[model samples]
Target: MLLKYIISHTRLNESSVKNTIKLLNEDCTVPFISRYRKEATGNLDEVQIGDIVKYKEQFEILEKRKIAILKALEEQNVLTQELKQKIESCIDLITLEDLYLPYKKKRKTKAETARKNGLEPLAKIIMSQKANDIESIAYKYINKEIKNVDDALEGARHIISEWINERTDIRNSLRNQLERHAQISTKVVKTKAKDEKAQKFRDYFDWSESLQRIPSHRLLAILRAEKEGFIRVKINIDDVRALERIDNRIIRSNNTCADQIELAISDAYKRLLFPSLSNEALSKAKEKADEAAITVFAKNLKQLLLGSPIGEKRVLAIDPGFKTGCKLVCLNAQGGLEHNETIYPHPPKNDSFAAIKKIASLAEAYKIEAIAIGNGTASRETEALVKKIQFKNNIQVFVVSEAGASIYSASKIARDEFPNYDVTVRGSVSIGRRLQDPLAELVKIDAKSIGVGQYQHDVDQNKLQKELDVVVENCVNAVGVNINTASIPLLSSVSGIGPKLAENIFNYRNKYGVFKSRKDIKKVPRLGDKAFEQGAAFLRIKDAKNPLDDSSVHPESYKVVEEMAKDEGVTLGELIGNEKILQKINLKKYETQTIGLLTLQDIIKELKKPGLDIRESAKVFSFNQNIKSITDLHTGQLLPGIVNNITAFGCFVDIGIKESGLIHVSNLSDEFVKDVNEHVHLHEQIIVKVLEVDVSRKRIQLKLHKK
Candidate 1:
């Protein structure tokens, strides 16, 4: 029954969802199931598999709640057969809670006090609309506690109010009304009007918009403003209209009993129903906003992690600065720090000639093929200095983003790697490695600190972390990892290799040289057969005895490749990377009950290009040398820029200035660009036309150049 419900909800094939859930129950990771168990899952991708996992967990939670509710009802002696059937059949939490609300234990409310005064029969008479003279009926219940007819009727009205509040149909109707018609409004705190810290939220100080239509970013901003006590927020619908809908449902006639019921309905809506439904509406809207924000953050993190890499090269990296001189480091091809120094070329201590001579000597001495300059303070001036130097070898200079370099520098990972070096030297090394391989270096820093997300801190932290972790895992597996050189963090993101095993692998490598083959990974402590089965395919080995081990081809499929080689009358090495030989082989012949056509097809592709880095190589980008700051930008001036950050509204471009420019969605292209990523990507270099510049606000607007 649960499987059928999940299939209906996700619109997925029943067989596939069933098989996927079975595999998930067996402790298979998403990457493993999506990549290796494709035949079982009918070729479901990671996203689909992830959805199945999420929904299965959600349904399990719901079932547990139902069990607890049933047990509670039984303990209270209120579990009728009909009530049990209704609870068992209910699928949604809201309706289940609505049914359970009246039975729930509560404090001594006014209604409970009235029942204690022996007015239950009078309240029931009024609710039935059968009492013509409520005063006489009420006077009969009057005693020492209930003094007069007025007091008795008032007590009965309180009991009726609780009845209206507990009615499931009435609560559901009011909830629907609030969700459809509620509006969110914010007002600035008068005392905080002149505070400098509150100035950032000026635009949201007097904002009002339909709760359903407010954009995720705007809503998050308003919520943050409210959180910081700069503004007060409220969500409300038309009270009179909501009350009328409730009245129509409760009122059957216009007699005295009906008049008393009307009073109860008004009291119920004002004191109980409105607050409950309005809060529920706001909670639901916030949840939607959080999901949207987390999605954006996940997308941006994926693009940034999978950005172009420059491959292996000896590099000279500079952490640019003014008063503190430019911190420099020379990294080997494998990104190991060979040497470190400082150059005071910018200001305060302007030793230009000395800095130039030292840089030239270092380039020759270290054979630096490329120079990576941090795009931070004094970045443009430092780039100019590096460009002016006449080098012995052809060297390309790139301005790499230094968003989380400072954070990483002070982190424990940095301290462990470079205990003798200060933050500046460590930061320079990070800039260099980021150019060599973005995915390997970026996994060291937290995704939130990468500075590419939209309101990352304002969203749900746990959900954001989970989504970002999935993206990192997908990217790491998509581009296979080098088992010999991958950091503990990067290796931890692989299929089944978590932090403890990652540490073991790293420690094993450090103690017993580099990993000679994928099989050697088993020798690491606590890495069992299951871990190897899930992780071996994604971990690549260079110059291994088995050529397939160096590629993404799993070790279990080595026999299949040997068979293909034998059929072709060639050696394994000869059969690898020979497209002519690969194309001649029939994949159907190798398919076994365990291995399907999908896995065989993937093997053939891997044999075509053994251990290919799918990511594009980084290209040299040059900004408009004349434009250094926002003051130098002019409207209509065309300049080269790199897309730095993307949001729902638009993309932010780094035009080699301290302040990045925004290209609003409308200005992204001449045609309608529904998705920003469809037009531009993170770290993509493009030419843009400056539209406007606001010096006071430090905002620059630009448009994508047509040509």
Candidate 2:
């Protein structure tokens, strides 16, 4: 039953969902199943597998809620066979909640007070809509609780309102109306309108838009404004039309009882129904907006994490600044900090000659093959200074983004890694290491702090973290980890390894020696068979005795590859990377029940490019020398820029300035732009024509340059 619902909801293959769920239940990770268990999942990618996991968990939560509702109904002695079946078969939370609404516990309210006054019977008589003289019927119920016939009728109306509110048909009708016709409107709090902190949200002070048509970023902005006491947000619809819809569902004739029912419907619509449904409508919209924002954030994070890496080389990295001077650190090929110092080359002391000599001497002494300068304060001056020096070796200079570097440097992780160093030196090291390998160095910092997201802080934190964690795991496993050199943070992102297990592996390696092969990880305490099965394939060991250990071929498939190698009359080392021989081998001959053509094909592909880095090598990028700041910009000027951040509406470009420039979606192309990512990617270098400049606001508007 749950499987059918998941299939209907997700539109995924039944067999694939079933197999993926089974693997998930048995503790297999998404990366492991997608990479090594393709046969079981019909070649579903990580995204599809993740969808299955999501729906399966949702189904479990629904079922658990059903059980809780049933238990409560039985305890109340209101459980009927028909109602039990209805609750048991309900698929969604909203529907199930509607069914259980009448029985839900409530505090002291008008309806409860009316029931205590013995007016429920009179209310039921009015609901029947047959009695013409309802005042006389109400008179019989009058006592100390009800002083007059009008008072008795009002009490009965309150009871009737509760009944109307509890009706599933009525609630569903109102929900449909709210879903289709709700408009979200906001108004300025008069006092906050003049507040300085409220100026960012000034545009939304008197805004109104269809809830369905509003963009996610705009919705989040309005919500944040309301949350911060700058504005009052309300979800509204045509009240008269809404009330008429409820009336048509309840009222039967033009009699006194029908009139009483009409009055009750009005009370219900005003006091109970519309307010509840309107809030629900706003909450649902916020949820959808959050989902869209999180998806954008996750995509941006994946691109940033997988950004180009300049492979292992001796590098001198600089964290540029003005008042504080530039912090410089020399990192060896393995990204270990060899030396550190400060240089004031730009201003204050005007020590350009001494700073230049010190940098040149350091570069030559450390045998620096590449230079990484952080794209921050005084970055242009630093780059210019570095370019003037004539070096012995042709050292490539790259302006690496320093987003989240300061946060990571000041964090406990940095303190643990560099106990004696200050935040400045640690930040400089991070700049250099990120240039060497982004995935390895970035896993230590919080992704939200990386500055690639749109309205990241406004979205649901738990949901964002979950999604980003999955993306990190996929990216980490996609580019297989070097078992010997991977840091604890990097290893912790592996398929089944958590922080504790990663620490154990690191301690084991440190106490004993480096991991010689993938199999050596099994010796670490608490590293069980399950962890090994899920993680081993994503770990690489260089110069191992078994050449396949350096590749992504799982240990379980070792025998299959070995068989293929034996048939080819060569060793595993000789058979690997021999595409000519690999392609000639018949895959059908090696197919087993567990290992089908899909698995065989993957095995062959892995043998071809064993443990190849899936990312491009980082290239040196220099911003236009003339455009140093916003004041240097003008309209119709073509300039080179790098896409630093992507949002739902557009992408922000870094044009060698402290403030990034925005390229709205409309300016991206002549055609309609659906997704910003399709036109540009994070860190993509491109040429843009300046469209407008608001120098006072530090805003630069650009359009993609075609020529």
Candidate 3:
């Protein structure tokens, strides 16, 4: 399998790949692996393992689906062993589905019943085109069983026609050709309903376009428009044109009967082949939608994983709501919330000034370097109010994504953190901490609540959630954490450190003392040797017992590194950070295929800059006080936005508005899109322009350019 090949070729270890396959088979969650299995996986973090697991799963699914299709064909007595083997060898689902096209179940057709009667030979005679007399063949089958001329012709045609269509290989060939050549057509027509509701599909009137060129967002929109009775959709493909090749074959293969066979082939295709093939193209388009959607989601995650962080700074965060006012939490440099408050700035609009006054006072007293504003209801208004106050220089304001703030606010972790406060306070703390450490804060909430992907709820939740969790785990492990300061929740995502071990680590810290070195982590209760192996590299001990121990160097490979450093006549720390010197090490000297060239290469890279955080440096983003309402939007004005959600169509970016604007997938980039995610993703700050604004529906269409 390609997945196995990739695992073998990549720098990622073989045991990690094997364990991922096993864990995926057992349906153990990504969080489970990242949190629990350290040593067994060589402390391979969630992201790398997740990537492997996902690829393995996709390969497995494609393989099994192929088998299922082959079994179905076998049941119909249409599958040969050679054909079965060929199907099994297929790699992609598209190819597998194409192979199964003819054997697929469908409504009962005239062809099957016609074969039950005795008119097959007469049908063959007409189809043979060898018939010097068409009436003579028709006469032979004219009886009560074969019935009249109409019945006899119908029965004969049905039998011969079905046999011709049963050539699954030809069906497979034609489907591929048709999908590439097809066009989708749609029309909007009036329906019976109240006012404009009935005319929902009226926008698609007279739309016609190539299927290949259609954007995912537009396709999903049109499908939805049709579903709402706003349009009638149809897909057009040159199936007859595609089958022309097959027709020529039948005619060329059987010379004397060529003309008759050609006619029969044409009739068979015209009556049955074209419609089925066109529909098949439509089905394939939908599959493309799913693949596109997943691809976009993956891109969104990539961006989110790469999102910048607000370096060690005290931040005052506010979670705005209707009845709840603004929940405020002040988080220290280590992401521990030092204080909480709920000050009403709107609704009970009388006390709005007081809330702003308190925010400024707290900022001054705490020496807060940043103000993290949650992008939720009343958020814009609250931000506008806060901007009115004069803060000391360098206290930046950030409109943070408050996605899943409520979920974390209501979680047990939140409760434990603020047992004496309200849920709103917990939510505020979550918002503040999210800006400080997204991966850390996010892990405390359910992956689904992060709200980064499209149709997330509608898709197979089990699969989607699992994949998303894996994405999160991979992101978390890619960037190591400070064990001394990390919350138990954050520690839980470390490879080999599950919830139980996270608790143990923290508990051990609370009892014995804070760990001053990476080696001391093994002493944490329930942290087995296997767990230590996977967890240690990703858990940094700044100012630890050994400087190299604080780096990403795995403990198992410590000796090799020490030996290399010794040969270089330098300490491990000096050798590790010496990029020029480290690059010269010979791979053969590593002397083990178990740790291949790829692994050696990764090690060398890490040695140059150990404990490298994959995240980008944070930027200061402030909400515009003057433009607080949708009505304030100008046609070509450029604005900053945080990508809140991504769909196959495009990214939904919140620009401090009540509702986010849609940057149509078509507007995503100048490049032709096989995947939307390649251009943009979640939590990414992007520039956009207001293309169209509809106040009535609260809809704002946006384009991705600095207009």
True-vs-predicted CA distance for residue 525, candidate 1, Å: 1.4
Off by over 4 Å in 3: 1-109, 121-146, 192-202, 238-272, 360-369, 388-394, 410-422, 445-467, 483-535, 541-543, 564-609, 635-655, 659-707
- Return the lDDT, model 3, position 586: 81
Report every candidate's CA lDDT: 0.91, 0.92, 0.73
In TM-score terms, which candidate is top? 2
- Of the candidates numbered 1 and 3, which has the greater TM-score value? 1
Quick one: ranking by TM-score, best first? 2, 1, 3
lDDT of 1 by residue, 306-406 (tens): 98999899999999999999999999999999999998998899998999999999999999999999999999999999999999889999999999999
Best by lDDT: 2
> What's the candidate order when arranged by decreasing lDDT?
2, 1, 3
Using Cα atoms with residue i matched to residue i, what is each candidate's TM-score against the true structure?
A: 0.97, 0.99, 0.76
lDDT (C-alpha) at residue 39 in model 1: 90
The alpha-carbon lDDT assigned to residue 43 of candidate 3 equals: 68
Q: What total of clashing residue pairs does each candidate reach?
A: 0, 0, 12
